[model samples]
Target: MKTLLNVLLRLIETARILGLNYRDLKNAEDLLMHNEFGLCFDTIITQMYEYEIEIDDELYESISKIGDIMNLKPESYTFMKELIRDESNIPKPLKDELTRIITSLIE
Candidate 1:
């Protein structure tokens, strides 16, 4: 089972991939430092969606695992749906992953 630490590590990985410094996610970092795991997770997830950073297959899988550790916000579905619908832009595997997440959310 994925843990909160795994989620935090994934978030840091995402920040690096996005070329964002760890300090840039100050709110999430502070929340995490304060042991506010849920809030920190939510903040990082929201920031990622809002940033619309490019996601590869590996990162998508990592995010899926992180999502399993915490209930994803409804916004995640909307954002993922947008990605899945953009067939020209998203890879098949990534779309499949998003579909899996959406199906799980509804179940």
Candidate 2:
């Protein structure tokens, strides 16, 4: 379950990197479903750290909409915190980038 979640999260990160809309997760899913799923979530998370993508208010609104469709509570900080905790091994750069992204969305 963790692995799957991490894969999905990495997909989200990748989508962000490519300037893909988070609200359009179908595109992300389609892009990732074909890729090999063998990599460790830590590795993917680390890559996310290496890449910095800005998350603005528009992105947050889009994420909230996507979360709603996916039955995820975007308003909850707990899930975000848990993601950060579980991905603690991520590189400082990617972690900082993601932190800024998620933080902006939360606010």
> Which candidate has the highest TM-score of all?
1
lDDT (Cα atoms) of all candidates against the true structure: 0.63, 0.45
**Residue-level error in angstroms, candidate 2, position 99:** 19
- Tens-place lDDT digits, model 1, residues 36-81: 7777766766666555555555566666666665676555534533
Query: What lDDT does model 2 reach?
Result: 0.45
Model 1: CA > 4 A from native: 21-24, 71-107
lDDT of 2 by residue, 1-107 (tens): 44455546654665567554444545445544654332322233233333433333443454444445445444431122222322336645577889999999999
Report the number of the highest-lDDT candidate.
Answer: 1
Ten contiguous residues with the weakest lDDT in model 1: 77-86
